[model samples]
Target: MPRVVFLLVPRVHLLDVAGPAQVFSTADDLGHPYTLTYVAEEPEVATVQGLVLRTETAWPSLAPDDLIVVPGWRGPTRPASAGTLRRLRDHHASGGTVAGVCAGADALGRAGLLDGRRCTTHHTVQDELARLHPRAEVVKDALYVEDDRIVTSAGVAGGIDAALHLVAARHGPRAAGEAARAMLVHMHRDGTAEQVSPLLRWRSHVDETVHRLQDLIETRFAERLPLRLLAEATGCSERTVTRLFSRATGLTPLAYQTALRLERAGHLLERGATAETAARAVGFEDARALRRLRARPGRTMHSKEASWTQAHP
Candidate 1:
């Protein structure tokens, strides 16, 4: 069993702590055997939401597989104690993974973990984090960033995405997908996907039918999904589905599916897959279609052969 130790700070955001905790806890319920522990400077810590939380003062023994998460807090950031900072540094030095959420990245910076590594935080604090840690590469407008073994995320709910990513890294995407479904998270965003990814861009509406249609298309993007099949799945007429999807997401059902396919193909290509393999894997009939998509203006491939590369690499 791997232990997930949460280092709670004063005035911590409730969701930042609860969201990721729920992910690991649910993974445990799903037979992943993750043990969660909460530790703070004192026995009791007050939250920014005015709720007080109890914690253990002593740090537990940790192994490389164990994770240490620092949940962000509210108000002006304060530096942690030298001893606490040392513990963070020592843990990663011993091959453990350390993560920072929102303003909690300050703690990682203070511990020298972010130096020479790529990281991110709440947009409001991006410049401040960069100024504080000049050696760190601060990525703006990203949901999260994982460089080497250190992970950092943007503000608030971004912690859930980052934690889900960690779950996927540890137990595979299937486990992470199950955990996300259990939490009612409709979509699981990849770390490489920016804050405004196509996967999440059109999800800000309240149309359940559109959402369902998108979910179906996203899950089976590689299959040939006819408009009639999509309409039937969502219990709407083909014309209604088209209008609703277009009105909500600014794209037709087929266009949305094509976007998903292209995005996945980009990732596959970035990982060194040949264009033919990527096209087949992402449901494209051949590399020619993928090449045409890439050749279109503003549709660059994400691999080294193209313009954009992996954020970590």
Candidate 2:
């Protein structure tokens, strides 16, 4: 089993810790032999979300294949004890992997792990990180980075993208895709991709109703889902459902469905499916309709084989 240890700081960002931890937990639920634990500088540290977290102050034994992560905290950087910093350095020096989310990278920097390593932090503090660690190569606008045994990510929900990338690198893209889909994440940001993917444009809502609608659209992209069916399923009037869907996803229900169909068709085409066959597979009326759909902006697709293990280096 691979062990993952998350080191916490005072007033830590809840999502920063929860996002990545949930990824491993989800993977473990799916039958991956993953062991997760939490350690902190204090026995009980307050979180930014108004909850106090009890943590193990003592260090845990870990094998070289195990992972250690530092999750970001709430305010300005507060220096941790030298003994704590030394543990981070010692773990990586012993061939274990270490990672950070957002300001957590500061902890790695203070531990001297960022020196000469490619890394990133939240966009708001990129300059500060660069100035503080002149020797570290601070990458900008990237969701995450990995150099040798060190991994780092941008802030907030960037933890999910970074964690998914780690899962992909270790298991396979299929496993990562399964985790994303299970968590209702619609897009998988690449390590070298911009912090935000265009596929996720205008998606900044947390309403369960809109989420349920999108989930249905994603699972049944190839079907003809009328607006009334969606509205009724969401238990709202058609006007209200349409307004909310547009507000939440920035696309009309039909537009969202079209995007989904085109996306699915792109996957089929990459797998050597003919245009007619792919169009039929994804609810397009014909090959001509699929061709016209593909003519839209950013509709070009790359055909990657189903074999996820060979997709990346």
Candidate 3:
């Protein structure tokens, strides 16, 4: 098994570590050969999340396939020792993968890995990174950037995307998708930036009854949804349930289910899955039906849910 070493710095953001850790861990659960370890400048490092992380100060022997991940910390700055910087640069030069999540890119820049390389950091720090490392090509607002052996990412949960992209690139898209599903994260497409698919987020409203109904449909959407059962779950008659659902979501129950299936089918198609397979997976009787639904006027984002990022926030 190839070993994955996490270089822990002071005042680390727990999720930056947790996100990629969880990604590779989940990939391991899928039976990938990966061994995770941690190294720190000290025996123990403090985290921004009010936790102390115990790590090995002694570096381990790593092969060409081995990896080192630098997770972002709370403060804009971290005290990376001379030894840490040497390991990062040396390992990458020798064919190992080195990656940074969010502001962890700063560490890579300091290690000279970002010099004349395409990279990115948290959006808040991209300009500073570019200014400090004049030779580094820092892509602003990128979900993540990969050049040669180095990978850098944007802020917060963008680490998840970066890690998953690494998994997809190294293993295969199917393996990465499985890992994502195991982690319960929406695996967004690579390149540019993406949030939780607006299709999924659009369903997030405060109507408990509608939420329950939608939740049920979400799980069994590929199967026939019994309107009576949904109505019963909503504590109302079928007609009343339809009215209530429309009032809450501005769509009939069937319309919402169709939308979910269509969106899912579109994603599958984007991933190179055949239309027939996508249709079957998303509950259409056949590819022809899915094709018709795709042709529906205003089938795509049109509701207040359209400007989802701004609409909700």
Candidate 4:
């Protein structure tokens, strides 16, 4: 069994912290043994949602062989303290897999481990990260990216996918699938899937607000969703809604909604809706309008073809 320790700091994103813990915890149910532990700078930490997480171990006692995981810190504007950076560097030097999720990637970037390495963070933080760390190749097109042992995921729920990839790499695809089954979430996605694109963010988090917005958009995608309308509907200020949505889910409300439409449109096409009907069903005024908004970089043919094969067989 591989010993996996999740490291969190004060105000860590809850989903990012919890998602992988569940993935590794359920591994034993699938008969793929792996021990999961929560470690922190201190013996306890507070989550962004006001939950207190009691750490099972402290940083200094972490073993070199243990997989060290870092969930995203709460704020990007605040720099990681030098002491935290030092410990992270030490963990990397000790030859363990050091993984960072969302803003945690910023910590790795600040520690100089990401220099010349391909990495990613929450898409909204891209500009700040590029400005801070020029040497790092900050990728924007992956759910999670792994460069050797240093792995980083794009924002919140992407941490789950990235963690499962590591689980798959270390154990096997079956183990990863079993982990996802435990969560009732999809299995590991191909690395080529859009990472930071608007399409990806709509599917990013399992939070209440995120899911509320997701359901709203899925049900009302054909309707134009301006920022003000979303804010009004959610009872938040437009700016607050946008920022929180971006921070929690890595996308602006409108973009996330559009992505939802595209995804539904995809399903409609897969169900044999003509392009025009698919567009209409998903709220597009015209099929050509759907084409302009389909930023996902491929035809809907792959899904349709798979559906066709299933039916033919």
Candidate 5:
């Protein structure tokens, strides 16, 4: 049985910690043999949504092959201390798997473990991470990514998906399926699946302009989206499009357009659409351009055969 350690920080999100815990702990019902524990920088941590939990171990006493799961941190903009970074780096160097869910990727990035590795975080912070870590291949279209020994998830619910993926990787597909079935969730969304694939769900952004522009961009993904034209379509100035787009989506107009194109291309690919067909459908001139866009490491295009196989096999 693999030992799993959930690493917590001050003001961590409860769901980020609880979602995976509930799934792993379900094994208790089956009388399976696995050890799961929560550890913090200190002995106790408070969740952002007003829950407090106590830890059984501190960071310095971890063992190898013990999966260290990092929950989302309180804020993305805060700096991680050198001591914390050293511990995380050393833990991974000693052959342990470090997994981060949602903003937890922020903590891994701070530990310098994500440098030059493919990784992801909540979509709202993709551009910020890109600006901060140019050496890292920061993916915007993935729910989770596993590169070398590091794993990362996109946002809230993504934590669950990533956790399930870890279980699958450690045990097998059936184990992951059982875990998800036990929890009544989907198993094995390709690691490459977009963190923000459901564009419609982006309405929850704090800014109305941001939400409106996101809707407009997604609504017209197939159309040629000139900045001036998009501004005109939204009844806002081009400057407003440039500014609000970044604030709400953490991406500029061009980046947003690219994201939509990639998403549509993925949808087409999953339906077994040919590269040529998928490319044309999503406004890419040809399959070559679509390939260029999707050729980034740590992402894959699932064929229609693969999609149906996973669904029905």
Candidate 6:
């Protein structure tokens, strides 16, 4: 079983700790073996939310596959104790993965782990993080960044996305998707804020009708789903469904379905599936439709896909 350890500090933000912790806990509930541990410099730590949390003062034995995460705290950055910094550096040197959320990146920087590493933090502190650690390449407008074995997130809800990304990387997209669904997290952004998963994109609104239609379309993207069936599912007229969906997601129902199919087809292609096989599996009539979509302007491969291609080619 992989162990996930969270190192808490004074005035730690509750959501920064809970969000990622919940993701891993949900994954564990879904049969992914994960042991979560919490540690702090003292036996008790106070949160910015005014809650006192109890934690272990002694560190646990960790392996290469285990993860250590530092949740951000409130106020200015404070340097960690020498012993704590040593533990973080030694764990990473032993090949364990380390993550810093929001202001937690400051901890990693003080330990010199961010030197030459690409990292991100809450947008409010991005400039300060860059100024403090000149050697670290601080990424802006990114939900999270992973370099070497170091993961840094923008903090708050962005920690959930980073945790989901880590889950997808460790397990698979299916597992991550399952966890997200269980948590009602229908939106999933990639590393950059501008890019997101097709299945999870355009879902930031609170329109119940549109959400109902999206749920239906996502589950049946590989099947023939006409506008009438979608409208009937939401008890709305075809025109209303079309109008609401377009307004909420900025894409027509058909366009949304097409994006899902195209994304699935891209994944299949990356896994060595032939064009015909992928197209048929993703509801394309044939390879021609898939080819057209792939060849269309502004339909270029995502950064993750491009990286896969470069490695495999």
Tens-digit lDDT string for candidate 5 (15-117): 8898877767765454444678887657778788888899865553667767778878666435346776677788899988888888788778888888999
Instruction: Give the Cα lDDT of each candidate.
Output: 0.86, 0.81, 0.80, 0.72, 0.73, 0.86
Kindly indicate the candidate among 5 and 6 with the higher lDDT.
Answer: 6
Q: Which stretches of candidate 1 lie over 4 Å from their true place?
A: 196-313
The true-versus-predicted C-alpha distance at residue 289 of model 3, in Å, is 22
Query: Between the candidate structures 2 and 5, which one is better when assessed by lDDT?
Result: 2
Residue 41 C-alpha lDDT in model 1? 87
In lDDT terms, how accurate is model 1? 0.86
TM-score per candidate: 0.67, 0.65, 0.65, 0.63, 0.64, 0.64
Ranked by lDDT, top first: 6, 1, 2, 3, 5, 4
Which is the leading candidate under TM-score? 1
Write model 2 residue lDDT over 1-313, tens digit each, in one string: 9999999888899999999998888888877769999998789988899989899998889889899989998687584789989999999999999999999999999999999999998878899999999999999877899999799999688999899888888899888878888898766676654565435543568878888888887788777777789988988999998788777766676677666666667667754689999988887667887786577555523222111121111
Candidate 3: residue 34 lDDT (0-100): 86
Q: What is the Å distance of residue 200 in model 3 from its true position?
A: 14
Per-candidate Cα RMSD to the true structure, in Å, reads 8.5, 9.4, 7.8, 10.2, 8.9, 8.5
Question: Which residue segments of model 6 deviate by more than 4 Å?
Answer: 77-79, 194-313
Model 3, range 1-313, lDDT digits (tens) per residue?
Answer: 9888999998988999988899899999898878999999789988899999999999999898998999988765554988789999999999999999877888888899999899988867789889988999988667889999899888578888888888888899888899988988865556464334435645757778888888888887777776788987878899888777778878766767777777778778867899899988887656887786677664543334332221111
lDDT by residue (19-122, candidate 1, tens digit) is: 99999999999989999999988899999999999999999999999999999998874747899999999999999999999998999999999999999998
C-alpha lDDT (0 to 100) for residue 135 of candidate 6: 99
How does residue 136 of candidate 3 score in lDDT?
96
Ten residues in a row with the worst lDDT in model 5? 304-313
lDDT of 6: 0.86
Report the C-alpha displacement of residue 148, candidate 3, in angstroms: 0.8
Residue 167 of model 3 has an lDDT of 87
Q: In model 2, what is the error at residue 41, expressed in angstroms?
A: 1.6
Clashes of each: 0, 0, 0, 1, 1, 0
C-alpha positional error of residue 97 in candidate 3 after TM-score superposition, expressed in Å: 0.8
